[model samples]
Target: MKTLMYVFIVALGTLACQQEKKIGYVDNGTVINQYQEKRDVEDKFQAREEAFTKRADSISKAFQLEVQQTQIDARKASQKKAQELMQGLQQKQQMLQQQMQFEQQQLSQAFQTEIDSLIIKVKTFVRNYGKDNGYTYILGTSDAAASVLYGTDENNLTQIILDALNAAYQKQ
Candidate 1:
C-alpha cells in the first residue's frame, strides 16, 4: 500500500509539472480597428453628429432673426408696453436656449452609451472566443511588435477573433 501511494504521488506531481501548451495571444487593438462593425458604428456616429450640428446652427440663426424682429417691434410700442414685450422676448429666448442645451446633453449621453455598449460587445466576443476554442490561456497584446517577439503568427488569432466577433454581432 505504501508503494502504491508513492506511485500515485509521483504521478500527481508529474501531471502538475506538465502545463497546457495550447496558449494563444491576440492584439485587441488590431482586432477592434479591423472590425467592420466598429468602423460602421463610428461612421454612423459621425454622420449623426454632423446632422445635429447643422440642425443646431439652423435653429440658432432662425432664433436670432426672430429676436431681432421682436426687438424692432418693442422699440415702436409705448414705453410700458415696449418694456413688457422686451422682457417677454427675453424669456422666450432663454427658454429656447435651455431646450437646445438639454437636447445637446441628451445627444452626448446617447453617443457615450452607444460607444460603451460597443466596447462591451467586443469584450464579450473575446471572452466567448477564448472559451469556445479550448485555449488554456489567451493573452491580449496591444503592441504588435512585442506580441510577435513572444507569439508566433499561427498563434496570433486576431483574424479569427474578428471574424467570430462579427459573426456573433450579426447573429445578435
Candidate 2:
C-alpha cells in the first residue's frame, strides 16, 4: 500500500511539473478570403479576365461579320467556289478557336500559379507567427476538413493572424 501511494504521488508530481501546451486555431477560409494580398491578386486577375473577354468578343464579332459577308458572296458564285469559300471559312474558324483556347489556358495557368504561391506564403506567415509568438501548435480549421472542430473564442487566432498578415502586406 505504501509503495502504491508513493508511485501515485510521484506520477502526480511529474504531471504537475509539465508545462501546459499553448495551442490556437485559425479558420483557413477566413484568413485566406480576408487576406488583402490575395484579394489584390484576385482583382488583378479579374481585370485581366475582363480584358481577355473583351478582346475575344471583339475578335469573334469581326470574324462573324466576315463570315456573313462571305456567305453573301458565296450565294452569287459558282457551287464549287461557294464550297471552297466555306472550307476556307471553316479552317479560319478552327484556327481562331484554337488560338483563343490557348490564350485562355495561359491566363488560367498564370492566375492559378499566383494564387498557389500566395497560399504558400500565408502558410509560411502562420508558421513564423507561431514560432515568434510561442505557440505550441496552431491548427487550421476549414469547412471541408476541420483539423480543429471546436476552439474557445479566447483560443481562436483567425482574426489576430489575419490582421498581422494584412499589416505585413500593407507594409510591402
Candidate 3:
C-alpha cells in the first residue's frame, strides 16, 4: 500500500511539473464598438428612426387641424361626424405608433442577430488562426472588461484579430 501511494504521488508531481500553454485573448467588445461597420449600422438605424418620427409628427398635425375644424361646427350631425373622424384619427395614430414600436423591436432583434453572427465568425476565425499558427487558446474580451483589464499589454490580440476579421469580411 505504501509503495502504491508513493507511485501515485510521483506521477502527480510529474504531471504538475509539465508546462501548460495558453494562447491570447482580445477585447472583442472594444473592437466591435469601435468598428466602422458597426457604427454604420447604428447610423442607419438612427436615420430610419428620425424619418419615422417625422411621419408621425405630420400625421399628428393633420389630426389636430381636423379636430380644430370639427370643434367649430355647431350642428349635432356635423359634431357627431367630427367626433367619428377624430376617433378614427386617434385609432390611426395609435396603429401607426404600434407599428413603429413593432418595427423598432424587429430592427433591434435583427441587429442583435447580425452582431451575434459576426461575433461567432470572429471566434471561429480566431480558432482557425490559432490552430494554424500553433496557438493553444484564444479568448474573447467582450464590450465589458470581465476578462480583460485596462492598459493591459498581456494577451492583447485586438489588432491581430481585427485584421483577420476584416480580411475575411472583405473576402466575403
Which candidate achieves the best TM-score against the true structure? 2
Q: Per-residue lDDT for 115 in model 3?
A: 75
**Model 2, 1-172: lDDT tens per residue?**
9999999999999999897889999999999999999999999999999999999999999999999999999999999999999999999999999999999999999999999999999999999999999999999999999889789999999999999999999999
Across 1-172, the per-residue lDDT of candidate 1 in tens digits comes to 9999999999999999896767888887888887777888778878888898899899889988987887898888899998888888789878978987898888788878877787788877777777888877777788655544587788888888888877866786
How big is the positional error of residue 132 in model 3, measured in Å on the Cα after superposition? Answer: 2.1
Clashes of 2: 0
Which ten contiguous residues of candidate 1 have the minimum total lDDT?
A: 143-152
The 10-residue segment with the lowest total lDDT in model 2:
16-25
- Residue clash pairs of candidate 1: none
lDDT of candidates 1 onward, in order:
0.82, 0.97, 0.73
What is candidate 3's local distance difference test score?
0.73
Where in model 2 is the C-alpha error above 4 Å? 1-17
Could you tell me how far off, in angstroms, the CA of residue 36 lies in candidate 3 after the best superposition?
3.4
Model 1 ranges off by over 4 Å: 1-8, 141-154, 167-172
**Residue 163 error, candidate 1, Å:** 3.0
In candidate 3, which residue pairs clash? Answer: 28-141, 29-143
Best by lDDT: 2
